[model samples]
Target chain A: MSEIVLSMKGVEKVFGAFRALGPLDLDLRAGERLGIIGPNGSGKTTLINCITGVYRPDRGSIHFQGRDISHIEAHRRARLGISRSFQIPRPFNGMTVLENLLVPLDYCHIDGSKEERARSVLTSVGLAGRISHPSESLSQLELRKLELARALVGDPKVLIADEAMAGLSEGEIDEVLAILLALNRSGVAVIMIEHIMHAVMRFSERIVCFETGRLIASGTSAEIAENPLVRRVYFGE
Target chain B: MFSIDILLNAIVTGILLGSVYASLALGLAITFGILHIPNIAHPTLVVAGAFFVYTLAQWGLDPIVAAVIGLVPFYVLGLALYLFYSRVFERRGGANVLQSLTLFFGLSLVVEILLVLSFGSELKSVNVSYIGSSLKFGALTVPYRLLIPALLGPVMIAAVWLYLSRTNSGTAIRAVAHEERALSIAGLDPAAVKRHAFGIATATAVVAGAALIMIGPVEPFGGRFQIGRVFAIVVLAGMGSIPGNLVIAIVIGVAEALVASYLNPSWSPGVAFAILLLGLAFRPQGLFGAAR
Candidate 1:
């Protein structure tokens, strides 16, 4: 097995009397492409939130690079190379596309001039030509690219993409998928939280499925596809 | 009918007055406009700054130089204020706009009361060589008192604008106001950005205080008269647009000066609100702001 980049052991979360997620154990290896899938309210997002420090897990611990990181603040984790994109793209509406990328770079502590890094990041995300346009004026596909660029500027060790391909067309989805594959090829670990079956299966080397806040299946894409529990939870088969 | 002399004087006076207004609104532009903190006490901070200048002037220091010397302590005070405000309100649930406004309002009153107790209600003025001097150019007359302090306003605004646009930490400050989570995910401590922004806002108070003392005199409760006018300028300029504040402040200043000279001094105060209302109706995002 490759070196574990992230480990979540028996993680649990509760909102008042309602249990959002719990007793979940998972591991992500360096440069791995892992996909998380579940129906609405199945605690998929909740799990991501916990790992990203948006919420503190009620039980269990998360270790990143063998260090206890479950309790660190979100920004500190991001500084430690764990970055996430929001489900809804939240670009600074007042800033230009290039400025959006500049913001994350400013915080990432990357060793380079801000303008140089921002321009390079935008170019990498295929946004080189639209640097001057206001962020709000970006098309839906372009917004996704900006969101990805924002996360990418940090040079994150673990990139948690939450619904990155949502509301994009089929062709756009492929473009995003190719980008993710390229990123993974460069050795950055990625956790793709997606609802689209084909896209998730195509991008992930490993897959995990959740049902009612519990991990129902975890295996390779082919294995997950063949699992009866996953089929029932996903398609009511 | 507007005569050439009247028009020239009004325009010159308006420009000078606008610079003063810019100084007055600069701190609020950062605290309320950029940081989204609705610091109603901003004018009071300016008043406090003016008093500092006055105290230094009494000790034979130039008002402008005194304000400069006071910047460090005021910046530190701003940090403390932000920490307190954040702990009491923002940390609880992120301060709602109305709640913040109320807190700042109370703070303003506390500052005003403290000033009254310390310096009494008498109006205080600072003396310098140029306070009574003026420049003559044909039909236009520009008072040195107005022109010198006025220059400080734009200088401060330009410096801040450059800082916000050209520097890395400045970009983070601008972004923190918009998408706080985005800042967090970018590896920045959002609260720290806000605190820095608040410090920047407070730092402006020192420069503006010097300008206030230089322009004329300031009383313990002088900040009360400026509350509506400064808010009007920040809103009219578009929040967080530092350069935009200069243009908006000048426009309002000219309008107020023209009204005071030609119409009535009483009408000068109303012009700011009128401009604010009109600006909001026409361009709610402000003249230079992106429509959110």
Candidate 2:
């Protein structure tokens, strides 16, 4: 019943003869933390790729804020407030942490004074003192923080975090979850593509499951846990 | 034995000689260093830039001013060139690095051939009041020709440094070289960033061209001779470090001058490669590059 912010209608994607994802329909409402879970090749990334304009879906259209954004380029989509983090951590290896933050501040033109805004954002992501350190030297956890900081710098209306916590330790996962929670609380809608069940359940109010590029189930965390299809897809009884 | 006079003269001349080398390599430092384009044809573009200066010089404009004026058109040309390259190669999931190399190589040839057809393969030089003068301070005698071109290096380096560090567009150029995807997340089109960067790189070619013609004569095929030398400067400076290139260019210039004066002039061409190999052996990322 909440105002829908993004609508994906009958979206389909294929790579050559292989159907990678979709012919699926989904909607994301304002201020919702929706967790998308799927097995390794169940097209979770592919779906995000389409929505973020990394790939042009073969069939159907994506409506963002009531605009048909199917043919828009990825960067344009980002400019329009849709941003995605890659599954693998990708900080600019050749820049310092501070320089990395300045890149987004400058590129997005979010604020007039780049230096002041970059410093503020670095502090917001708990990277205030490490600004001058080289990005390649960042620890795994630090890298994840930098990745999140990168997504947040654009002041995106919708943030698609594709496995942002993957490869982090349990404690680091909690740290990132806290950051996501904080971001959601700031009124940004988030689509978390995660394989970690407990974390997803803890973070998501609603959940969606995918199997072979098809949406298998969508419901509250408790209802999804009770669904028979969700059980068979996971436990394969 | 090296006399005090010879030593002083060699050092002074080395500084002058380094300035010319810096001018020649400036465009490459931006193109290959900043953009990671591996634009082997950069020196050729500088040569082309020199020819443009020559044309305007014949029209009686100051060569330096001519080069500055040429920047806008060259920037636009660079943008078009990058767009074409992206459309043909990068858009197709990036045809292996070597494939891109071959494309640039072919492009270099086409440009060289076109230059030959248009300019008739004749070596051309610029004429100015300072072109034939020299400055003397005690035992040191510096040719005005050397002094003029030498001065261009530092001034241009400072200007480029300011642009790269103090401007918003400058940061975008540096970012594109490091992590292109980061640009997308920042709400900028990666293609546009690259195109703008390519334009900046090409703009340098005109300045370098002015310096080249001021120092000596240039022909269409002259770029081939500078290919290795320019690349060495860019790599030794570290990719995208604009101010760093000035220092490395000077060092290589002094080394080449020393080699030509004491060892053998014929061996000057090898100085860039030797220094490049040694620089890679010690700090592969370059003198100023971030350790990755």
Candidate 3:
């Protein structure tokens, strides 16, 4: 295997009477594109939460770049190059586009002029022309770009797109996919937690399917699509 | 007969008084307006600050100097207060309006009772040379006490506004209340930002306390009278609008002064609520705030 950037082993989470996730193992190589697919409440969110330090796993260890980081706080993880976009685009409203990017650059401890870095990220996301526009003024596509730009501004080693394409039209989805591809090409690992079948299949080199908190299937997009368990869980008996 | 001279003097008085009100409400603009904390205890904190200044002023210290001295301690108090509050509420997910109201109301009472135990319920005023004198110009008589303290409101407002608008930590404070997770993604702890903002808010209480005592004597219960009006000012200005706080404060101040001069002084306290209700009916987002 390619040098693993993130390694999770036997990571399990429980909520009172329910085991939300794990007793599972997963790995992502540096600069790889990974897709995570699961029906609602299959523990994808819980997994992401544990990885981002939003919640402790209650079991197991997660190592990032050779260092165990299961107990680190969420923001510290972001500083450590683990960043995520919310399923619902959560742009810092009332702030201008440049100001939105500045929030991350401000705290990322990135060495450079914040204004220049913000401007450059906005440009990379094709938002250079709308730099000063208020976040509320952006169209759906633009807001999505802003969220990605926010994640990008941290210069994260791993970027999690949590339903980033939910409400976008097909054309808009292509635009976002292109951005993610470009980001991945720049050596950032991407985890596309997507429900859109075609897009995920197209973007992911490796796809994993989750059913009731366990990894039911793991393979290339072609293998996942053919997996009997994945089809039964996703489609029907 | 409504005398032009009396009218002018009342108008000037209202403007001066409005500055004082701005000083009082500036902290609220950050605490309630920005953070949405509904800190009903702020006025009482102002009273505590006044008493602090009083203790120092007894040794012939300037009220302003005393206010400056108390800033760090008051800031610490604010940080501790926010830490406790977030522990009780935010960490449990979020604080509902009723829960926050009750918490702050209880805190206000505690502070008031503490003030009583320490300083007694008696009225206290600081003795400064400028306090006893008034400036006369063109039929308007302005007290130096009001003018000097009035300047604090604009100065404080400008300083805070600049910090919030131009600085990095300031941006984090503004962003924390809106989308807290965004701050997390930005690598900032949301609770820390809120605590810092709350500390800044409480720090202003000392300056405003100095202003309050300079205007007139203050008792432990002095803040109770202001609670309603300061809330009205923050709401009417539109939440999170710094400049709007000053403008609305002045408008309410002028109206109250006009009312006291032309109508009844007792009715003056009602002026803020009256404007607040009417302003809300018209611009629910606030006079200067962005629509939610």
- CA shift at B5, candidate 3, in angstroms? 2.3
Off by over 4 Å in 2: A107-112
Candidate 1 per-residue lDDT, tens place, A52-137, comes to: 89898999999999999999999989888898887899998777898888777765556768778888878887899999998988
Model 2 Cα lDDT, one tens digit per residue, B1-292? 6777777787788877777777777777777787777778778888889999999999999999999899998898788889988899888887576877787788889989999999998899999986798888888888877788789878887888788776767777777787777677667777888888888878888888888889889999988988888888888888767777878888888888788778888999999899999998999989988766
TM-score attained by model 2: 0.94
Q: Candidate 2's error at A44, in angstroms?
A: 0.7
Task: Assess each prediction's global lDDT (C-alpha) against the native.
Answer: 0.89, 0.84, 0.92
lDDT measured at residue B121 in model 1 versus the true structure, 0 to 100: 91
lDDT of 3 by residue, B182-285 (tens): 78877888888899999999999999999999988999989999999999999989897899999999999999999999999999999999999999999998
lDDT of 3: 0.92
**Every candidate's CA RMSD:** 1.5, 2.0, 1.5
Worst 10 residues of 1 chain A by lDDT: A103-112
Greater-DockQ candidate between 2 and 3: 3
